[model samples]
Target: MIDIDPNGTGLPGIDQLRVIVGAVMTVGLILAVLALIIAAIVWGFGANSSNPHLASRGKSGVLIACGAAIICGAAVTLTNFFWNVGQAI
Candidate 1:
């Protein structure tokens, strides 16, 4: 019988990949926050202008921005969760 190491994939640069992914996620989180702020400003303007169409679009933008933020914020957690799941397989 051969012994297998679960933690040994013999793959190189995994740490570097993790670092790159982390940096990308950080940038994405920053962009999502910016988008959320812009959406809020647009919502305020639409509300003040009393434009239903603009207001509706702004509302949708806010939802999307929030979703983006959530995804970006949870990226590391999600990645680790999936990684653990994979390892368990």
Candidate 2:
């Protein structure tokens, strides 16, 4: 039987890497939410101005922001899943 440490896999700097990844994820999520908000505002303005091209751009921006949010939200789950896979190997 093999034992794995939840904190690390007996590798140096793994903990620091984890911390850096977590910080990046947090910042990414914050930026994604801000982008979503800005997209919504732009969409509103475009709609009010009757600019289809601007509205479409805003819509695409909103979609991209939502996608970023989804990825960021799933970061922990994805990390855990990969961590477990590594442990099994």
Candidate 3:
């Protein structure tokens, strides 16, 4: 075990790790936003059209976005859970 100060005065590796996680999460969030925007646009434009295929495609896009969001949420939730368990160790 290593001593990690609450302030930035200890644990160099831990600090680097936190930076890496932040960058990864930021990119994930950007992707999530893009997915959601695409889903919304598809749905909105599809609603105004009479083509069933377009509507189906819109629904598919929405489903894909929902899936992406769920995966992201699950990953974060599981990570937090394991992190907390680790802290108890």
lDDT of 1 by residue, 17-65 (tens): 7789889988998898888888888888899999878878888889999
The local distance difference test score of model 1 is 0.84
Assess candidate 2 and give its lDDT.
0.91
Tell me how far the alpha carbon of residue 42 in candidate 1 is from the true structure, in angstroms, after superposition.
0.9
lDDT of each: 0.84, 0.91, 0.76
Q: Look at candidate 1 and tell me the lDDT of residue 75.
A: 75
In model 3, the clashing pairs are: none
lDDT of 3 by residue, 1-89 (tens): 78653466465688788789878877776787798788777777877877667767878887887787677657768877887897778
After superposing candidate 1 on the true structure, give the runs of residues whose Cα lies further than 4 Å from its correct spot.
Answer: 1-9, 82-89
Q: After superposition, how far is residue 74 of candidate 3 from its true place, in Å?
A: 3.8
| TM-scores of the models, in the order given | 0.76, 0.76, 0.60
Better of 1 and 3 by TM-score: 1
Model 1, position 67: C-alpha lDDT score: 97
Model 1, residue 64: distance off in Å is: 0.9
